[model samples]
Target: MDEALLRSLTPSVLAVLVRRGADFAAAEDAVQEALVEAVRHWPDDPPRDAKGWLVTVAWRKFIDTTRADAARRRREDRVEEEPPPGPASSVDDTLQLYFLCAHPSLTPSSAVALTLRAVGGLTTRQIAEAYLVPEATMAQRISRAKRTVSGVRLDRPGDVATVLRVLYLVFNEGYSGDVDLAAEAIRLTRQLAAAIDHPEVAGLLALMLLHHARRAARTAPDGSLVPLAEQDRSRWDTKAIAEGIGILQKALARDRLGEFQAQAAIAALHADAPTAGETDWAQIVEWYDELAGLVDSPVVLLNRAVAIGEAHGPRAGLAALAELDDSLPRHTAVAAYLHEREGDLTKAAALYAEAAHKATNLPERDHLTRQAARLNAKRRA
Candidate 1:
């Protein structure tokens, strides 16, 4: 299916069509046409200027569609042969495309779907697979997202931040479905960072890299979640780690310290240690504290509890965790860790079982279940 050709051409295809002034609907249709053409032609004559050819052809096709639709005749000249001179000359249209895909007017799910389609060059079926939904469901989602943004004006400056956040979510899941969402996210974020001047975008890229560096060690081949301390330190991606640290250091020096920057700081601290034992728990706790203040989310608080536990004592961690809601998903797991640390193996084993049952994903469930099994094995021994 000309996979490499498609992957290489996709970002540019979407970007050029959009930059030529096609709205989401038109740009999407144009890119789809280009894909169909690629499938038909790439076996014989691969165009020399693949991206340019796709963009030029898609732009023309989009213009034709707009002209034929009586309703769209009002702006037949919506796009000029060449765009006017603008701010940020070095800025690429791909960044603008991200903002459009992540337009707040669209629902979060829809935004994700659109971004996958437009930027990731994924078909509707692929997006549906990742989201664990039907292809038809995801198609409707993309379509609705397109229609929702048709009326909204989107050239504002603040739009880039929203775009960066949406991409951040894509990277955070690490991996999903058949696609490596984390890799796709890193690719897109790099595109955005290169095209834009925003420091937060750089910060998001740094954060994604830091988290992604740990992915190889995050899970075992059997799909078991590897605890941070148990992870094979050698498996960590040193290149991603170095890049993350360099970018993070630069962002921290800016003194903006946005939420993304704070999270990156925490990740950087963890990555700096030779082993989990060598981790700067005190600094990590401080970063988590800053993050909690910036985002005010319970998840951050729960994570901070773990850091506090490492920095101080298990009992202190438990005390901090006690302040959070019992309904939180991390509730039982944190309790089990605290109990185990405080020398209550029996109670800890019981809590581990509960945590396993409550776990959301397969790896996490398996991890907690194994924790219980270890404690059980000790009893039998």
Candidate 2:
């Protein structure tokens, strides 16, 4: 099968159906039908007009589905029964698909899952694998999301903020089974930045790229976490750095700063320096200040603590961390980080293990666990 061609056409197919006023469920069914048809035909007879073919087949499938379910009332036929445009759809179709998938009405988890499935052109199994959830569970989640959006009125106004949050979640997830969440996040963010004029969206795209550019050096070969100070500068993706810088510059010019824009500014500062030692920690602290002011989220404060360590000292950072609510997730992780910085490996190792126990995601928990193991091993060695 022409997998690349299918991937290329998937978003366009969904976007077309959405534009034609099919609610989310009907549109997804249409795309699924197009996918099945592609699998059947592409190997034997690859079409020169994949988009047109999918749109035609999907349109027919949507009509068939509505007709079969006598329960569903057919809406007024608003979309013209027009032929497909000459040539294929522009890449903007993919952006539209993400925007539609991340529609605000859907729950955040549902929106993320649907965007990965529809715009990301990934299978339910693939998404399931990525999030470390059972395939059946992910299937149910996606289906439930579809049902929720089925009868809702279609709105094209991009949920830029929600889209950014979804993309950030994808990026921060690091990696997963058969899916590179960071890479996917970058792709989705690029599409979002292109499709929307929101500076914060652009800021998020830049931040993801900036952090992603360093992914190679962020983990040891055995999957152990590597602190930023120890990461090899040569391993960073220079092209991604360039793009990130460009986006950050554009976002900064807008003057209407949001939390994401401030975070991007911090990432940009880190990326600009050739060496870790050269990072403008003072400037980063300023941006973090702005971010703290923008959102009262505990994670923001936690991040600010790390930045305080960089700008001030470990003792000061630990002091700042102490002031935060003890009930927050990652509280122990911040304490462990600060303790590790303070030359108190004993306390750090114990706290790291505690952090691992409290961590929400597997990668982060594993990382902290490994840190504790390494420290224990080092004491013996």
lDDT of 1 at 155: 60
- Highest lDDT: give the candidate number: 1
Candidate 1 regions exceeding 4 Å error are: 1-12, 15-21, 63-92
Q: Write the per-residue lDDT of candidate 2 for residues 95-194, one digit (tens) a residue.
A: 6667667777788789889888887677888899998999999999999887766665544556667777777877887676978878877876776676
Candidate 2 residue runs with Cα over 4 Å from true position: 1-5, 67-99, 156-158, 344-346, 361-381
In candidate 2, clashing pairs total 0
For 292-334, candidate 1 gives per-residue lDDT tens digits of: 8889799999999999999999999999999999899888999
TM-score of each: 0.89, 0.85
Among all windows of ten consecutive residues in candidate 1, which has the lowest summed lDDT?
82-91
